[model samples]
Target chain A: QQQVKQSPQSLIVQKGGISIINCAYENTAFDYFPWYQQFPGKGPALLIAIRPDVSEKKEGRFTISFNKSAKQFSLHIMDSQPGDSATYFCAATENSGYSTLTFGKGTMLLVSP
Target chain B: DAGVTQSPTHLIKTRGQQVTLRCSPKSGHDTVSWYQQALGQGPQFIFQYYEEEERQRGNFPDRFSGHQFPNYSSELNVNALLLGDSALYLCASSLTPGKPQHFGDGTRLSIL
Candidate 1:
C-alpha cells in the first residue's frame, strides 16, 4: 500500500508564477512531513518541512501548509524561477521506533522563462 | 564536513552475477540507510544500519544484504542479480534514524 499519495505527476508554470504540489497520507500517526528537491545527476536536498503541531510553515520562497484533520499537506513556491525546475518528493514519518519515512511518487515541476 | 559519499558512480552486471556498493557517511554521522529508485519512481527503502548493526529493514528479499563497519561506513551487496534489479542505489546518512537525512549522488547499477 502506498502510504503517501501525491497529485499532478507533472506540472509546468511560467516564471514568477506560483507553483503548487499536493500530498495526502494514510497513516494518522505521521508527525513529520518534509519535502525534497532533486536535480539531475545529484542527490535530493531538503527543501522545507512541517510538523503536525503547526498548520503552516514558511521559509523564504518555500511554504508548507498542512492540515492535520485532513491528513493533507501542500508545498507552494512563491515567485517560481526557471532554476526551480526539478523533481519534488513529499515524505512522512511517524517519529517513533526506527522512523522510516514513507515517500510519495515525485512530481516533476518545470518553470518556463 | 563531507556529505554522504558513494563510490563506483556507475556499474553494469549481467544476470546471475553479483554487485557491491559502498558508502561513507558525513562527518559525525553514525547511521546509514539504503534506498533503491527506479525510473520515474520515488525511492524505496531497503534497510538502515547503526553501530555496525542492522536496525530496520523494508519489504525486500533475502538477496539484499548489508554490513556496517566500525567506522560507520556501510556496504550493500546484491546476489544473483536480475534485470529487474537495475536502478539507482542511494545512500543517506543521518545523526539519528528519525532525523533529516543527507544523501549522496548515488550509484547507477545496470543489470543485463
Candidate 2:
C-alpha cells in the first residue's frame, strides 16, 4: 500500500514560470509533511516542511499548501529556474518518537532556460 | 558541522557474500537510520538506531541488520547478498528518532 501518492511523475516548466506538484496521502496518522529535493548521485536534501496545524507554509520561493481534512498537500515553486531541475519527493510521518517516513515515488521536474 | 558521512561511496559483492557499510552522524546528532533506494525510485526505510539500541525498523527482511556505536556512528550489515539487494544504501542522522533527518551521499552497492 502506497501511503503517499504523488501525481505527474515528471514535470517541465520554463524558467521564471511557476511549477506545481501535488500529493495525496492515505494515512491520517501523519502529522508532519516534508519535501525533499535530490540531485543525481547525491542524497535527498530537506527543502520545506509543514505541520497539520497550518494550512500553508512558505519558505523563500518554495511553498507547501496542506489540507488536513482532505489528506492532501502540494508544493509550489515560484520563478522556477534551471537549478530547480531535479527530483522532488513528498514524505509524511507521524509525530510519534519512533515514526519512520512514508515517501511518495517522486516527481522529476525540469526547468528549461 | 559534517552533516552525515558514509563510507566507501561504492562497493561490489557477489551472490552469497556479505558486506558492511558504515556511517558517521552529524556532530551533535544521536540517532541513525538506514534506507535503500532503488534506481528511479524513492528511498525505503530499513531501520533506525538510538542510544545504541534498535528502536524501530521497517519491513525489510532479517538479512538487513545494523549497529549504533557509543559515538552515534552506525553500521549496516547484509549477509548472503542477493542480486535483488543491488541499490543505493543511504544513511541519515537526526537529533532524535522522529526529528528531521540529514542524509549522506550514500554508498552504491552492486550485487552480482
Best by DockQ: 2
- Local distance difference test, each candidate: 0.93, 0.94
Tens-digit lDDT track of model 2 for A9-86 = 999999999999999999888988989999999999999999998999999999999988899999999999999999
Model 1 regions lying over 4 Å from their true place: none
* CAPRI tier of model 2: medium
lDDT of 1 at A99: 78
Evaluate residue B74 in candidate 1 and report its C-alpha lDDT on the 0 to 100 scale: 98
lDDT tens per residue, model 1, B19-100? 9999999999999999998988888999999989999899989999999999999999999999999999999999878778
Model 2 regions more than 4 Å off: A96-98
Model 1 interface DockQ: 0.67
- State the lDDT of candidate 1 residue by residue for A1-112, as single tens digits: 9999998899999999999999999999898999989999988888988999999999999999999999999999999999999999998888642577778999999999
Tell me the lDDT of model 1 at A58: 100
For candidate 1 chain B, which ten residues in a row score worst on lDDT? B94-103
Q: What is the TM-score of each candidate against the true structure?
A: 0.98, 0.98
